[model samples]
Target: MGKVRKHSDSESDDGEIEFKKPRPAKKKKVETKTAEKSNDNTRDAKGDAIFALSNKRRVTVRAFPNGEPAIDIRETYVVNGEQRPGKGICLPLVQWKKLVELLPDIEEAITALPKKK
Candidate 1:
């Protein structure tokens, strides 16, 4: 004779039971030394190019993760005998372009201001 079993609430009337196993957590990727070094090299090269210019400032146009265009403006300065970065500003690409287009008018307005004694 075959063995008989009592049915639980989770078991179907047809005598079949469903089981589910818990999934394992995903692991985060670790950055390699070579990748870090390459990033540093790229940063150094960009810094050199910015400082090599007479303006000592650079504007980088990039896209955000959400697909919005952005402009980053950074300036280099000498602080305590070492080259350091100054305060930076970030704006939308449209605003940056508008600012560029209005540069001549802005300069004229600035020059029109009365000089301080």
Candidate 2:
């Protein structure tokens, strides 16, 4: 005759399941040397581009009376937008042609001028 089985429903006789510990996150690589050099180069490039554009011809820039960019370019001042006068600074008519020749992205550059006073 086979042995009879017993059943109990009080609590788990076996131990609880165990989980593996999570690994630590990896740190990002730093490029301090390369980053520092690139910063100065970037600024120099921007300054050169602006200087080249302005040196071709003297284009005067003025501050708007209402503290916004002016709409029309004055004979003496280079009015750009209605909100700020100097904000729309550009090369003279003759120099504009040259500027466009030097930088095809002149339109984008001018449009991206700062709006803040």
Give one digit per residue, the lDDT tens place, for model 1 in 30-88.
Answer: 43221112432323423321222344565555566787887767776654444555678
When summed lDDT is taken over every stretch of 10 residues in candidate 2, the lowest stretch is: 43-52
What's the alpha carbon RMSD for model 2? 20.4
Cα displacement (Å) at residue 67, model 1 = 3.5
Winning candidate number (TM-score)? 1
Once fitted onto the true fold, the runs of candidate 1 whose alpha carbons sit more than 4 angstroms away are 1-56, 77-86
Worst 10 residues of 1 by lDDT: 31-40
**Candidate 2 per-residue lDDT over residues 1-117, each given as its tens digit:** 333344447575444444555667896543222112243241122122111123222223323455442222222222231111233353444555565587857777887999887
What TM-score do all the candidates reach, one by one? Answer: 0.40, 0.21
TM-score between model 2 and native: 0.21
Q: List the residue pairs that clash in candidate 2.
A: 68-83, 68-84, 69-81, 69-82, 69-83, 69-84, 69-85, 70-81
Q: Give the Cα error of residue 14 in candidate 2, in Å.
A: 3.2
